[model samples]
Target: MSTYFISDIHGCYREFKILLKKSNFDVKKDYLWIAGDLVARGPNSLEVIRYLYSIKDRTNIVLGNHDLNLIAVYSGIKENKKENYFDDFLSSKDSDKLINWLRSQSILKINEQQKIIMIHAGISSQWDFETMKACALEIEASLLSNDYPLFLKSVFNNKINYWNSSLRKIDRLRYSVNAFTRMRYCYPNGKLNLICKKSPNVVKYPLLPWFIISNKFKEKYSVVFGHWSTLKDTRVPSAFFPLDKGCCWGGQLLMLRWEDKQYFYQSYLG
Candidate 1:
């Protein structure tokens, strides 16, 4: 069985299906790993969720920032902004079921046997795999708890841009989520530069992509990540694989077959 990894689909269900067909993906024999941003900014967010849910057993997903935002909006913790692209999903009869399933997904997926890790964004240099997994579980627990809506309400309000084990509960969870999902650039000291969405070449001094800052971890394992569309290409300094080819922004939907490291693409149909 082959494992295929894709990221930043952003609700382009048509292109997603096209790529699957092009790759000759077998639902029963192949496994699909999504790096995240499964829904948002495209025309068919609802359809994407439903389709993935139907194939849930064969799919592994890490929650992206957009996925978290969808949860917050669904739970009434955040406003549903115009560009968010979740109206159909929110209005659907299966909204609660879909959101619940989404909430159950982790922010980090580690395959120890393959020595590969998948996340929506990059992990911090400060964390080894075990430590990162522990932090991810902390946030996942909150997401799965009875007070998840409260957790969502509090998660986005904090400015704890750095990691500290002594941080309060909410702060710790927020920091973990940011590092696993929203982070792109960070200072050499590992403080996240959450505002700079530009490519690494254009960013000013003292800021580097999280992978560049976390060289040690990069050397140890292959990492699959998305969420930074401006990355422009998939190559980085280490075994880091970037899959967000900006499909939501008129680029191509990309997939990497993990066994042989083959890359496949299906361009935007618009």
Candidate 2:
């Protein structure tokens, strides 16, 4: 059985199926790792979640920014005031189960045997695997616990990027969520620059992508991540990689065979 890693599906259920087929996925024999963003931005999110949930035992998913956004919108963390593109997921026949499944996913998946590191957005350099896992688990508890709605609502409204262990849980929750999901660039002092969504090399400030800035993780592991939709088919410097090919924007969906780094891509049909 081959090991496959995918990311940033973004609710394009059709694209996902196409990629699954193109990759010749062997559900019983192969391991599938998803780097999150499994919902929102396209059509038929509920179907996507249901299908993945049905195969939960064979799947590994990390939460993407859009995935968390959908949860936030549903749980009243952020306003559902924007586009109602994912209304089907919110008003679906199985919204509860779908949301529950999404909330149950992790923010990072590491397999030392494969030497593969998976995450939605890139992890900050200051974060070693242990620190990253701690932050992710904290938010996971918030999403699954009794104060879930409160956690969701507060996760996106605060100042993201600051890292203060002395900060309250609420503030800490917001920073952790953003860094693990929404962050792109940051300063050397571990201050996040959430304003720029463009490539790291061309940023106005001298800041770099979290991984690059940290200089600690370059080539340390085979990192697989999704979320920067513009990174489709592009390779980053220092063995950094991006796999979110913007399938929701009518781009290609991508999958990587972890053992050999073999790749498969299919056009989005959403």
Candidate 3:
């Protein structure tokens, strides 16, 4: 069976459905890898969540920023902003289950058999595969635990630049979440740049996209990531695959078929 990687649904139930049907998704056969953003910004957050839950057994997911925010809103740690979608989700009968399931997702997944590593956002250049797996597990466990609300509120803030081995647990939790879910650009020395969300050329510093930064692990590793939908889809061979295509901005939702090469499908959010 073929394997596919899809990213940045952003609550577009229509697009999601279109992609699923058009791809001939077979729950028993083809594997579906979701690069996350399972909710927010579209008109069908609740429906999308419901649908995914119905087929949850067949899908493997990594949490995206919007998905994490949805989890926070559902858990009462963060209130839903008016601009943000998901009122229907907040008012749903199964809101509690939905929140738990969302939080249960991981920030990265690697399939050794397929030679694929999927992350919601880029990983730090400083981290190798083993380090990434370790850090991802630590963050995932924290998200799935009872202390997640505290993790979301105090420690989830991204302003912290200093990380120490002796830092408090909450601080470590926050750092892990940011590093896994929110990383985009990173300085040459690996400091995360959270403010600049534009494309790479817009930046003037030596800082660059996290995967582009030279590191001990560079040139020998493969990375597949989403987020920064501005990068859209690049023709950068398989060294780096960016699967987010701005579906939330009325652009197309993208899916990469990641076996022989990168076959793909798209659904316009218009």
Per-model lDDT:
0.89, 0.78, 0.76
Mind giving the per-residue lDDT tens digits that candidate 3 earns over 32-67? Answer: 888878888877888987888887887889998888
Q: Score candidate 3 by lDDT.
A: 0.76
Error of 3 at 158 (Å): 2.1
| Per-residue lDDT of model 2, residues 143-192, tens digit only | 78987887776677536577877878888788888888888778878888
Which residue pairs in candidate 1 have backbone atoms (N, alpha carbon, C) closer than 3 angstroms, thus clashing?
none
Best by lDDT: 1
Model 1 lDDT per residue over 68-107, tens place:
9999999998899878788899999999999999999988
Candidate 2 error regions (>4 Å): 81-84, 232-235
Which of the two candidates, 1 or 2, achieves a greater TM-score against the reference? 1
Over 4 Å off, model 1: none
Q: Candidate 3: how many backbone clashes?
A: 0
Kindly give the stretch of ten consecutive residues in candidate 1 with the minimal lDDT sum.
Answer: 212-221
